[model samples]
Target: MSPVAAPAAGPSATPSADRVADVRALSDHLPRFFRLVQALKQAAGVDGRDRAALVLLFPLVRVGPLRQSALAELVHADPSTVSRHVAALVEQGLVQRVADETDGRATRLLVTDAGRAAAERLREERTAHLAAVTAGWSDDDLAVLTELFGRLLDDLTAALPADSRPAFPAPREKP
Candidate 1:
């Protein structure tokens, strides 16, 4: 990439061509960010199969033992699709199904202890990877990046309006 021009240095400086160029340069960083996240996920030991398993397991871990219909809804996947993934996870001993006490005919899916361990390992790996990558970053630099990210997300969320947000709602209170 061509070098971006430096921003004007003045107490009352307004946006300049150089500042525009810099902002444009920053916009191009998103692909790099995506690649980094993908690499981090791989380093966390998530493969194609395990990635799918993680998608299915996340809801179980978050919402506890839930019915297949509820799990599917939480995951935003069709019941059959979630069922197949859950079946594979169950066979692998990463998830378990228990008879629902409230409804004997229904089964509730729960992540096994092994599954929690896997999730924890993945979390640790991701945290360590991010820490190592940002170890040399100054506090101000990190803070500015964090703030920029928050602003970007705010802009995106504003564009979507309330109805278009992800279907996942806040956890409901149990009786």
Candidate 2:
């Protein structure tokens, strides 16, 4: 089999052209990044049911009490899907439904102490996974990547119309 060729340097392209190419490259590479994160999640050793529960658990822990609909919006998942996972979480004692103080009839989802502990373990393990993945990179490089990723998310969210945008919270939060 023939070896694959390296991408062209595009040395003669204008700066704007170069940037546009970079953006295109980013679009192409974004899926790989997601897959890497998915791999990391799998490596965290959660079961299939656990995987779904943890998805909703971490966000609910980070954002505090939220209605089921809001949690669905926050995760960009279907409300019905969130409802099913939430039921499992409640059954597993990872989350609890509480009455909204503002409205007696309204229900909100809250992560339990067990949920917080589990999220913390997963968060730390994720960090260790990242550290291993980026072991060759400089600290400055890590910091810059974090800054750029945050800025990229902010810019992308801002580009959306106010009414149509999903709930985009800060990536990191004290739990």
Candidate 3:
């Protein structure tokens, strides 16, 4: 795949006028957008540490049951971190460990009904929040933005070197 642009410190790193302006705008805006999303998830999530735990439910809820190892890879979290989150979720009855029918030694994490309710509540809350935030935006505008944002994310992910690490690896715990 082709790279989007050159890296800093490279002799070819100089940007043309338009690309520089667009890149600058993205650099300024995307972080704030991400921060708002994270904050919204935290606020809408159950409480305290469960806030983080609840966030983990999004992937499982979206894709159905998954092994802890697969879930960690999908979420780009460390195995130990995923284990802790899964433990808390199981304890809270939001998720359960079930024997993987194909492999007696392995278990899949399934979201309980309570977990679905919590996830739905968080989804609704986020939807309401965004609707309010985008009150001034027209349907056409929203559609355009959605399409553009999706394309941007796809391109960004594609731009990564195949050998590079996943985007969000949770730091490993200390010994």
Candidate 4:
């Protein structure tokens, strides 16, 4: 019998000058943008002790209770990695795991009263910060800024490579 042929390697992707220019523009704003997010997180009392905890808890506050696997998917982290965060939250009395009715072996995570309180604090801090930062702007301008920033994030995330550790799922079909 003839030997089977090996799969061909894909072409190497390289960015052109235009792409470089686009990247440079983004790079120029990245430091300030990240610093702002860091400052906000710090103001909300998210420290080293709760870095991963904040990541896990923030989404829960926004989206409500979720299966451990689903939470992992939302965070773009492995199940084991998410489990560790959940464990920590549970130990701190901030999150509780309840057995799924349909599947006893499966569990859904719910934020406890303490978790809700913490999440509220974070939300308030963010709202106050945004309000203060945009104090000089009109309501219409603030609305436009919010809409545009979300759109920009969507566009940039869609443009990212698959290997990138996305904060959420990509807008594409999974293989």
The TM-scores, one per candidate, come to 0.63, 0.79, 0.75, 0.65
Task: Flag clash pairs in model 2.
Answer: none
Q: Show pairs that collide, candidate 1.
A: none
**TM-score for predicted model 4 compared with the true structure:** 0.65
Local accuracy of candidate 3 as per-residue lDDT tens digits, 1-175: 1224445676577866777777788899989998986776566655656777887898888778999998898777789988998999999999999999999999999999999998888778777888898999998887767766767766776787765444343322332
Which stretches of candidate 2 lie above 4 Å from their native place? 1-15, 166-168, 172-175
- Which digits, one per residue and each the tens of the lDDT, describe model 4 over residues 41-87? 66767575477675678888667778989888877788898888889
Positional deviation of 116 in candidate 4, in angstroms? 2.4
At residue 135, give the lDDT of candidate 3.
Answer: 95
Model 2 TM-score is 0.79
Comparison by lDDT, 1 against 2, better one: 2
Q: What lDDT, from 0 to 1, does candidate 1 have?
A: 0.73
lDDT of 2 by residue, 1-175 (tens): 1222344578785556666677688898899989987876677677866787786777787678999998888877888988888998888898989999999999999899998887888778777877898999998877777767777888788888886575646674323
The segments of candidate 4 whose C-alpha lies over 4 angstroms from its true place after superposition are 1-24, 39-45, 160-175
Positional deviation of residue 126's Cα in model 3 after best superposition, in angstroms: 0.5
